[model samples]
Target: MKIAFIGTGLMGYPMAKNLLEKNLELNVFSRTIEKAKPLEKFAAKISNSLSEAVKGVDVVITMLTDDDAVEKVLSDQDFQENLKKGSTIVDMSSIKPKIAIKYGKLLKDQGINFLDAPVSGGTIGAEQATLAIMVGGDQKVFDQIKDVLKVMGNPTLVGPIGSGQVSKLANQIIVGITIGAVAEAITLCEKAGVDGNKFIKALAGGFADGKILQNHGKRMIDKDFSPKGKVSTHLKDMNNILECAGDLNTQLPISNLIKDMFKSLVENGNDNDDHSALYKEIERRNKN
Candidate 1:
């Protein structure tokens, strides 16, 4: 099927490449053309403009930075005018559920289909094509695009219109909190003269063993805070989670504390580091 892929940044680049590798007729665009250039080797049609990228495509998948970026592209005259009727817009960006619901209705009113299909698994998952894709939209549209999404990861229809975002928020909550827990535990281990690496080894196969403890925990031990997922990005997700909690009249006390820790990381210019850099924040706290 013909497809248009937008936002070829860290996650988007690998995802677009996967689609191209599958021999999908793909058009790719990023505001910065350089970011979209590598896909040309895989036979992707790199477009100079959003209009050029999306025109006549059967599917338009967006993996932008945030809600505003997604909205900006979706509302652009180039995108609006060139997107053909009946084609689906699958927004894989992590955004507010309310915003997704609002745009889903707007697009539906214009004979377009919209899916909020945010993902987990970081840049690594995108590269490995193992992301957990939570989709919120019509079942039929989901079935039609299931194979296409499988080229990147597992796609499951969680609910209608906004559920994908809600599911994503839930995923982020667990990730953020666990990162904090792992960071604090590692700090405690090191301060007590215990090796952080052995700490992880000691916990393997226990209930505490998980992706975060193994993968991200190793990142912490090695001081590898490179941007698998950015601190600023996780901070944004934490903020979204709290906002959703507020709307539901619920209190997420631990998430609130974790949000503050992330805020501190961003304010101190660790925004570009991996979210695992929460280890830095915890380490900073223990310094006398």
Candidate 2:
């Protein structure tokens, strides 16, 4: 199937390449053309305009940053006026489920199909094509795109429109809290004269062990705060979660607490650092 891929950032770059490798007729665009250049060598055509990229494509996938970026890109005249009827828009950007729902209905009205399919697994997963994709949209549409989606990751139809984002929010909550737990545990252990790196080894295979403990935990011990997922980005997801929770009259005290911690990291100029850098905030707290 013909495809248009937008937002060629860290994750988007590799993802577009995966599609190109699959011999798909792929068109690509990024707000910054330089980011889109790399895909050209992989036989992916770079479109100078959003409409040019999306026009006549069977599937248009957006892997943008957040709600605002996604809105800004999708609301463009090129996207609005040019996308042909019956084509599908697969938004892989993390956004509010309600926003996803809002746009889904709007797209449906215009004879377009929209799927709110957010993902996990960070850049590593994107590059490896093992990311877990949670999709929310028509079952029929999902079935049609299942093979295409599988090229990127494991795609699961969570529910009707917006469920993918809801699933992502739940994912961020667990990830944020687990990072908090690992960070605090490491800090406390180090302060009490234990080796933080060895601590992780000791905890391996236990209930406290999981992917976070292995990957993010190692990052914490090594002070490797590079961005797999930025703290600011996680903060955005947390806010989305709290907002969703508010609409449902749900209380999320821990999520709120972790949200504040991430906010502090952003305010202190760690916004672009890895979310695991939440360790920096906890370390600061212990010192004071």
Candidate 3:
């Protein structure tokens, strides 16, 4: 099957490469043509225009940064018309569930299938094809494309229509709180003069151990501010969480605290750094 991939950024590039490596017919598009060049060795056709990239493709997969970019590509008249009936649009970006439902209905009316298939696991997960995918769509559609989803990650059909996005929002909430907890725990350890590395080792089999502690915990100890997942992205997810909670008339005290922490980091000009930089922010606050 021919697949068209849009937004070949950090996550998308590796995803599209995995699909191409599986020998699927692939067409790639990026806002900047340069970003699309790296995938040329996969022998897929590259297009500068969304219209050209999606035309005649059986599946259109989007891994953009936000809902606005997704809307921009989908609302392109040429792209809208070129997407054939029965074709599926898999949106892997983390966006609001309400927005996902609206777009899914719009595409359904046009005889196109839309799935809010948001993913977890960072760039490393995408590169390794081990990302966890939460899908929201018709069961039959998901069953049909299960193999395709597997090419990128282990995908689970969460529910119908907007369920995947809801699951993703939940995932973000857990990640936000976990990373924050990891940051605080490491900071406390450092202040107490305990070896952070040894702490991680001793806690490996305990309740304190988790993917967040292992992956981001190491970054905390070494003070690596490199962007695996940027502070801005987490802030965006926090905003979404707050908005979603308000709509549900629910309270998220812990997420609220994490949001404030991230806001402080962003306000202090660490928006482009990894979320693990929260440790540094905590250290800075302590020093002052």
Candidate 4:
């Protein structure tokens, strides 16, 4: 199908590349053209503007940063107005579920289908094309697009519009908490004068083994905090989780605690570091 993809950042870049590999009719756009440059070699045409990018495409995919970025881009009159009535817009960004619902309704009014299809598995997953995609939209629409999505990851329809974002928040909570767990576990090992790397290796064959321990745990002991997923990024999702919970009259005490940790992470000027950098915050607290 003809598709338009916007926001070619780290996650977007690899994802769009996967689509290009499938030879789907795809056009890409980035606020900074250089970010979209890598896709050009793979036959993805980089568009000059939002309107120019999305013009008349059957499916518009956006993998942006947060709610504000998502809103700002879709709010473009030319971008929305130019879409065909029966077309679909798939937002894979980690936005609030309620906001996704709002966008769903807004698109519905215009006779367009909208899907909140945020994903997990960071840039590594994006590059590996193995992300776990959680979708929220009409079942029929999801079925129709699942093939396209599967090109980049495994796609599942969790519920109605907004559910994807909610699901993503769940994923983030678990991810953030687990990262903290790994960090602290490693720190404990180091404090006991044991090698943190060996600690991970010792846990590998047991119940503690997990994707986080295998990947992020390795990053932690190695002191590699480069941004596959940034501290600021998960912080945004955690805050969105708390916001969603508050609106729903639910309590998420642990999520609140994790959100506060991320707050300190950003304040310490490591917001751009990988979310695994939660280890640093843990280190700070332990020092006190």
Candidate 5:
């Protein structure tokens, strides 16, 4: 089946590569054409415009950063008319669930299938083709593209329309809490003069051995503030959580705490850094 992949950033790059390697006919579109150049060697066509990328494609997959970018691409006049009827648009970005539902309805009106399939597992997972995908869409449509979804990652149909983004928000909440806990624990260990590396090793097999501790823990120990997952990304996710919570009138104290912690990290010059840089923020607070 022909596929169009939009946004070739850190996660998008590898996810698109996975699709190409799976031998699917692939076309790539990115804000920068150079970003799409690497995929050209894999027999993937590179489109300079969104219209060119999406035109005549059987499926268009968008892995952009936020909802606005997704909306811009989808609402483009060229994209709206050129995208064939019966084709599906899979959005893997983590955005508001209500936004997903709105877009789903809009696409359905055009006889196009829309699926909100936000992903987790970070850049490493994307590169490894092991990201966990949470999908919200029609069961029949999901079944039709299940094979292609599998090529990118393990896809689970969470519910019908908007459920995927809701699941993604849940994922962000858990990730925020876990990362915050890991940061606090590491900070305490540092204050007590315990070797953070050794402490992590001691807790390797215990209940503390989560992905955040295993992956972000190492980055924290090394003081690597590189962007595996940017603090801004988590900040956006936290905003979505807060908005969703407000919409449902639900109380989420833990999520609220983590959101503030992320805000602190961003204020401390770690906005573009890795989310694991929260450890540095915790350490800074301890020193003060």
Candidate 6:
């Protein structure tokens, strides 16, 4: 199938590369041409313009930074005009549920299918093709594109349009809280003269054990804050979560606290560091 991929940044670059490896007819576009140039070596057609990239493609996949970036692309007249009728647009960015639903309705009116298929799993997962893709769209459409998605990750059709983003928000909430919990526990143990590594090992195979505790806990222990998922990105997710909650007339107290922690990190210029750097924030709090 002919496909167009936009936003070839950190996560997007690897995802588009996986599609190219499958020998699909792929056109890749990035506002920054350098990012798309590498994919050309993989036999991807690099488009000079967004319209040029999308024209006549059966599907267009976007893995952008945030809702604003996604909206800027989707709202472009050139982008809308270039999309062929009956084509599908799968947005794999973590964005607001309301925005997803908004675009879903707008695109549906034009006979185009839109799916909010946000993902979880950092850059490593993107490179390894093990990302947990949560999809929200028509079942039939999902089935039609399932194979293409599977090239990058395991895609699940959770419900209708916007559900994928909701699921991602839930995932982020759990992630933020768990990171905080792990950091706090690890810090407490360290303060009490306990070995953080051994402490985590003690919790292994117990209910507290999870991907976050194991993977992120390891990052904490090693002081490796390189960006698997950036602190800024998680901050954006937290803001989106609270915005969504406010729209639904609900409260997320723990998420709010986590949001502030992320905000503090970003304010202190840790925006580009890994989200696991939240541990550093907790570590700072215990410094007395």
Q: After superposition, which runs of candidate 5 have C-alpha atoms over 4 Å from their true positions?
A: none
Error of 4 at 248 (Å): 1.6
lDDT of each: 0.94, 0.93, 0.91, 0.92, 0.91, 0.94
TM-score of each: 0.98, 0.98, 0.98, 0.98, 0.98, 0.97
**Model 6 off-target regions past 4 Å?**
none
**After superposing candidate 2, which stretches have Cα over 4 Å from the reference?**
none
lDDT of 3 by residue, 1-288 (tens): 889999888899999999999999999999988998989998978987888988888899999998798888877899998897899999999888898999999999999999889999999999999999999999998987889999999999989988998898899899988898898999889889999999999899898798999999999998898999999889988988899999999999999988888888999999999998878778888889
Task: Tell me how far candidate 5 lies from the true structure as C-alpha RMSD in angstroms.
Answer: 0.9
Prediction RMSDs, each to the true structure: 0.8, 0.9, 0.9, 0.9, 0.9, 1.1
User: What lDDT score goes with residue 25 in model 6?
Assistant: 93
Regions of candidate 3 where Cα sits further than 4 Å from its true position: none
Candidate with more favorable, higher lDDT: 4 or 5: 4
Candidate 3 global lDDT = 0.91
CA shift of 136, model 2, Å: 0.3
Question: Which of the predicted structures, 1 or 4, would earn the higher lDDT when compared with the native?
Answer: 1
Clashing pairs in 1: none
